[model samples]
Target chain A: MNKFKTTESFENHISKEKRSAKAKAFFINFLLSFYLFFSLFFSSSYLIYEKNILPSFFYFILLAFSFIFSLLWTSKNSSLGSMAIYKTNKFLKNRKELQSEFNLFSFSGIFISLVLILTILLGSILVDINLYLLFSSQGLSGAKRIFSALFQPNWNIISQVLSSMVDTIFIAFLATFIAIPIAFFFSFFAARNLMKNSLLGNSVYTVIRFISNFTRSVEPLVWAVIFSVWVGVGPFAGMLALAIHSVSSLIKLYSEQIESVGQGPLEAIESTGAHPVLVVWYAVVPQIILPYLSFTIYRWDINIRMATVIGLVGGGGIGTLLVQYQGLAQWNEVGTIVIVIASVVWLMDYLSAKLREAIY
Target chain B: MSKTILEIKNLEKFYENGVHALKSVSFDVKQGEFLAVIGLSGSGKSTMLRCINGLVPSSSGEINFQGQDIISLKSKELRLARKSIGMIFQHFNLISRKSVLVNVLSGSLAKVSLFNGIFAKFSKKETDKAMSNLELVGLKDKAYIRADELSGGQQQRVAIARALMQDPEILLADEPVASLDPATSHSVMDHLAYINKELNKTVVCNLHFLSLVRKYATRVIALKDGKLVFEGSPLDIDEAWFKRIYGEQAREVGIE
Candidate 1:
């Protein structure tokens, strides 16, 4: 009689608990959405429509609870709610001891996210931008026509495309090849560890760093345009631009690598009473050689990408051919050019990756 | 008894943060003596050795060597002085990527010209000497092998041979065997001993183990908190002196 009574009561209790959970889930979701819609409505309508502040003012208490117990009553009874409470208690316990505690305060994060949303809304109005136009009707047929033409790939111009692509690769290789030596030269003077002990060395380091940073800040395509104007539209201009830009980037990497070398070898070399040049020769160069080679190959890889873009600004590569086709509205020819550039870029990437593997 | 090759008088080193790493210490090293400096870690033995080569500058002191003051020497003079005094390190400090022969050849940096060294156009004579130096360390067979591939003891021996490339008047070993096993330590110490005994090079080494000090050191000195506390024959260091040198809580560790 006692067992029958307990089983019957347990089944009744289980159903009651589940019923309350279902009801609570629905009610909480409804309350959360209603409270949330007011802020969302205000933020979204800044430029599109003016909002009525009446709802936010009328449900002020509801808004307060929505923000305050945001993670509490909205979550499951024993899961997220209990976990958050447990973490908050743990943080408080650890705070008294002045030990490392988990970062739990979340008001700033929510505020930042809200501010970003508002900025985007206000910025769209100020800039007269419409991201919705990205899905416009006019460019749809153009994209479809280009893609369909990609399958045919103008076989007659294959040789021309191949030659231009090779020129592009050559421009990349030659530029990186040229830049690496210049960068390597500057790296030693630019390195902090090398220059830390002397006033003259410190000045040279700062100047080299500034030059590298300044040159790197200018985009490669812009450099290409400047060089094109200087050299009169040729592969030479492309190569020169890539070389200058790469030198700046490579200098920073190589110098940092030079600084990271082991101090033990440095001390040992210094104690040998070797000259300053000899110290760099024996101690610095050997340690940095592998990493230098690695960085140069990587820069070459990056320059291949630069080669394609520079040609668009009259720096003479596959991109010159690409722009020519596009100007004539020869979508089919442009498709072939795109296919050729992509495959070559992919090939160059593969080759460099293989080379890097062999080096390591 | 040999003549004194190096002399120190009233040495003082005050670091930037006001830590006195070496107090007003004084000592003289004879030409062919094997002197071991025993002390706790950070007790300024390394600093003292570095001061001898002008690797670390003394704030106030006389580091008189071969009738010349090392402390106040100019850059070129310092480099020239360093050429004759070869130093080996605890970590071996070999360029791990280079071959053993190249590393040994690097020791000839002091003697080579700036242009020749940068291009690594080592002369035939330099090459022969590097090979001979390798042979001395029994690393002749491993000449073309990468330095990091060698065992710790072997690397330290290579370091010893590299130092010999200077044809040094004085060899400084700063905790040379501190990273080696007991057997490896003895082997390394034996080479140092051979260099000291057969080649007749004066050796000043910093050691942690008392047993190694007793076995190898012809004369011993102990420093406590940067102050030189004991200096005499190794046999004279009794229990009371040991206690005072290392501190009251210190227990002696022995490596057979």
Candidate 2:
């Protein structure tokens, strides 16, 4: 009886250690979540206040959901005899097929709860502050306001949208076009298999990599702002910003693609007494052409969306028109513009996918 | 006086990884002699051939081609010299996306100016010469087809055609039929032999198959671990000779 009791105590100690390890993991995850939440809260504080939003209800909902999730997760390995633990064990035993369904149900439940809580908080705050009076005086409330202010049957909004769209397309096109030639030179230096001198090759690679990183680190909107100060507003500033971003992204993609090309062709070219440039042209470029095209098209699609957003800060695109509509409190016009932009993006995505498939 | 078309004197190559790939290797080829370099893999056979064409720069050596010391030539002169020495690879490295015609045309780039080469502005005579070379390899009909579309044997033939378009004085074939089936290998070997004999071009080929070396080469040079093990006519080499060169490893692998 004494030996049996000793064994039982040892088993209890092992279980306690396992529980503590799991708790440590959970604490680390909770700390990460808290950091992310606070960062978002601080960054968007001005927007929240201007919109007459209170985040207290959101906090409550987050806390409740987190508590429930932690309970569910911990209960799976719980030593305590509870119905929840039994159910969790059974669910885990059949995990593969049931996992997606469980995750979908839980995620949607949390999301809906958060949205409801935030809406309720914002509604209460707006009511307390009498915000409806401000909207009424500005002709921003009710059905007639949006259409009257937006449509006014004026060509200004239409012309602005058209010009902005052109500028965005041109920015994407010119940047990609210019970047290809520059990347072509740097990719050879970057590829390890091609160059004989490791020191020289690595130095060239490092320098080019530094330039690419510096270009991509700054957002296009920030680039646009700097360029606007230097060269004045309109499409040229947007073009310059997009071009710099493209050089960095294109160099990285092109170098990686060049590096991965099969060594067989390269060796063959080398053995034939061909020059390095010839080897690259005949061997490397042929293999990477399809992938390069696919990447360029994808970048162009991303640039189109970014171009619109950058225009809000005078980068010159559809974003300019959207901002103007917002200033005039024309929500219906904003909705129409949003739909048009979405359709354009969707069309480009479909076309790009088809083209990529055809090439491959 | 008989001209020494190619000569290597005390050629040495030490890889950056500190491997002595070739140690004081030396050999010579007359204007029209077919030489077979027989060696196992990693036995300095490839490094020896690449050094002849100046493809891999020798650490300390003198490669005299026709009379000039090619080892000391700078980039422009080296490129010009390379145009005269044609090479073929084991895997037939034709650009898969390019047609056979364009692949053959690529060989002529060293002879043409960089601007014209980039723009692909070869004269009509150059095109005709390329076509004739393709005809010599019996791949004239497939000249317009993308190289990837061809069979292994056919692609090797296309590579041969490309090399022939260079109008080279020396031809170096690095295991040209290693990737092909036995039947295809025989045909490719026949084509290389025909090019050597009919065109009177000096041929130096690296080969593993002894039967092929016996059938094609006038003289066979064997290497064992970056050292010259055998240098004699094909008739002089027997199973015992191969055994001596490859050692007990040959017996284990059952190459005899």
Candidate 3:
């Protein structure tokens, strides 16, 4: 009796497995067909809209063809979870034999490749790309003139470029220095884990998070424009702009570090009856100090790159000199400023990377 | 007869996710007894230990410790109350990057002013006491090393030393040996046993193995599905009671 029961249960298990496999195959096929139809229809419609030469009837016909092709292919092929399709009733008796029916190149693979090529073609049309025009006489001459002038940089402006480069670097330095303490103060309030206890704490968390997010959404260029109007066009304006953005960015980095701190040490310190400040000092500080230093060094690197650009908006630095020389069409002077900025940015990036490596 | 130092009445804890971690449970702890709370995982053992120290506030209960209800205490009062109750975790929750000596000295932050605590300026007396506690845990030589550099057993021993620096009246240990190997578990347990017997501090510990309870605990309490199932001497939990507490399919597994 036990042997008979075991045989029956084994049959039941196999039947259940077969049913689940069938359902899974159907779901996968349905999703693939739906995706194929959408991609084909959308790409064709986008092409017709952007090019605007094809008629409305042409789009409708393409859409209908995609829909009908996906439907008919899905119904006829009925993919069997792998590359094989369900074609005959004979293979239904043994699922294991279905593996031998695998195809090296399937219709779905061909259809997907066709759709990808169509997408690339549509992207070229959308961008209004004309590769032939780029290598035309007019384009080559424009490029040649800039290249010849750039190769002959004006050495007379080397002293001016060096001094303005120092100003740009100092703006980044002072901005980061000012932002460090402010971001450190706001980060504790912004961390959800730290301020989740009371209604007042939750409100402070929301307010700090909202203000940082709001300020961060405004790009440094826009902020530099605003600060130039307020503080008058100088390195101070650039410094203020970078400082504001850095505080928000650093708050986000610092608070996320605080949230991921191991709760074990925090609980241990709390259990010691330490004051709340001391709990944060002892537990949270040790875990976050290295990460915070790493993030600050990273932020300083970004600020240096931004300061060079912020000077373009009348905030005084090497960027102001480059823009001035460009406006006058003195490409040689512009080339000198460009080289100074590039070399400085590269050195800053390398130093920050090394500093971050040392910290970790 | 020993005096009851801690009294818990109808202790109920409902977590924010609507998990009823602890049902209406009540128990008493004597002044100097080593009480072992045993249960399966998620049976409210950790939650109960946390609630007693006001770490995880009880949903509704009265935990009377030294003439004060721990659940009703304000933040300042809670900090003051927590000073007398030293707790250690299974993970040995030391500030991993800090020196072992600094980790121990952090336990005295409750009594120091906020200004002094901020600068981590402990007095010579406190430093000496921290050293003595490290010596008690047989880790005086390891004091200058980083807390994370130690082995698991050594880290746990340092955690015990840090807890001892508080000079607490009651020590709550949450599954102190659950993360340790059997041999290391015995060594840590021996230190706890020494604290309970020689120093005469009341020790309330959460444990998993019945054999360890039989060896170390003066009294045992068993919890099942958030309800107290048994409260008696450890030796009284024989085969029948064990089967009932741990479920019928369960069999005792010994570490040694």
Candidate 4:
């Protein structure tokens, strides 16, 4: 109710303080933009970590170019420059060099200069990154040889490769199918918006959330290795591993969708005297069904790629065949397997994308 | 005999944030009367209606509806009581992805068995009822169309049909025509008036526009700062009473 109150005294007081405030805001904007430019130059020049004069000079030149570009951007009408100027002119009228304006500039300068020093000191500790390993001549040649082989993808191993690729697809399908329903069930228990009303409900949400997060944190390959050790090597172990991981991952996605389900429909349905379960069925289900389908198809796409990695860990599929051939110096066979897996993955990606677009 | 269908005694709602949205509010809706609740925004008109429907649990009060104290009822009992009281929102909160027919059919959820509901197996009788309700709102032809594909006014009409499927004896409309244009507001208001007159269902509606209250309401009540400030016929709210209900500086804003 106080928000509706407007008095003459309040307007007078605001006008009195307005000039100093606008000038301070203008000074802060100017100092901050300058600090941003200087920091950009310092960081880029410092990254080379070199003693050579010429390269260091070139790096500085690149940094200077970036600084000029940033200044130009910040001066655009859509940017903060025009806003500061407009406010200062509106409030200050004919005044200049106010005490508050000077204080704002000094305060902003000290803060940003401290940040620059800390960034340099911290970045010096963030090394161990080797540019030579990635950008060297030998590294370039190695990548070229591998990519060149993809063009001549040997058709000789088409039979072995095709069957292996089929196994990979089957593994993904079985895993996603088994996981989607389980994930759907868990999502209701895990949604904070649905379950935060009671102690029992809150605890159930927390426990489900914790379990899914813990499961998802461990990579699928690690799960496959453990599963294969427990239930010998084959697609069965791979399927189990993929299903377990997909459940946790999909549960996280599904619960978020459940949480974001519109509250308005829920309220309207609840007014009809529907039970909580029926409320979810009628109101919540309709809103999330399309998103759930899209997420499941996306999960399947992810799982197909994961199946290849899981197979390399001895949970059987195309990836197992891939490692076996690669180990025997059979580059030609490895090339064919890689080509087939890539094609299947591309086809799955395309179909899922189209379906998702249509559904949404 | 015009007996009371619903009665409230000293209703108060202090939300979790300590905002006293409603103070001690008390009123009664006589059977078959179209009572319009008139109030400024934040004057507890909505909270009063919501409390009667049991949409939000009241902090303290007795809401006697259909001879039972609604505020004290537990989960299943409350749901059973609610089945006979349908509500419509200003935004017409229909499930956008669902078809108009399915949205109406969903109103019968509380009365259906758990198995049938889970499988979404509506009986032929229920389907027929749903279709008839759609016909009531003049959206029978659009029953198969998605709720979102319809215009705002059409969606609210669909919501009316959905609420009607509950076979409710009383209806609560929370700013039912607030989001609509002036012409459409009259059209939607006319439907509520029709339902009240022809179907003989008791209605408790919250309205911002005073012109609407004068047109459709048989009795009027006004809330100011969560307290009942005025109650009488719509015509009885004279210039002095309107100033007392709204405010001294407030000008009456009206739709066609």
* lDDT score, candidate 3, position B7: 94
Per-residue lDDT value at B109 in model 4: 89
In candidate 2, which residue ranges exceed 4 Å CA deviation? Answer: A1-167, A177-209, A262-285, A323-338, B1-3, B251-256
Worst 10 residues of 4 chain A by lDDT: A1-10
lDDT ranking from best candidate downward? 3, 4, 1, 2
The segments of candidate 1 whose C-alpha lies over 4 angstroms from its true place after superposition are A1-131, A134-153, B1-3, B9-20, B23-25, B119-132, B140-146, B236-249
**Candidate 2, position A314, lDDT:** 72
On lDDT, the leading prediction is 3
The residue-by-residue lDDT of candidate 3 on B1-256, one tens digit each, is: 3999899998887654335678888999999999999989999999999999999888776999989999889889999999999999999999999999999999899979999999889999999999999999999999999999999999999899889888889999999999999999999999999999999999999999988999999999999988999999999999999998889999999987
Q: Which stretches in model 3 have alpha-carbon errors above 4 Å?
A: A1-46, A49-137
Local accuracy of candidate 4 as per-residue lDDT tens digits, B1-256: 3999998998877654335677788888898999999989989888888889888787777899888999889868989999999999999999898898988988888888878987888999999999988888888999999999998889888989888989898999999999999988887898899999999999999999999999999999999998899999999998999999889998998898
Error of 3 at B165 (Å): 2.6
Once all C-alphas are superposed, what RMSD does model 3 give against the true structure? 10.4
Q: Residue B195 lDDT in model 3?
A: 96
Q: Candidate 4, residues A23-43: lDDT per residue as tens digits?
A: 444454555555565555555
Instruction: Kindly provide the TM-score of model 3 when superposed on the true structure, using C-alpha atoms.
Output: 0.80
List where candidate 4 sits over 4 angstroms from the true fold: A1-127, A133-155, A325-333, B97-99, B119-150, B240-249
Q: Compare the candidates by TM-score and give the number of the best one.
A: 3
- Docking level of model 1: incorrect
Q: How many residue pairs clash in each candidate?
A: 0, 0, 0, 0
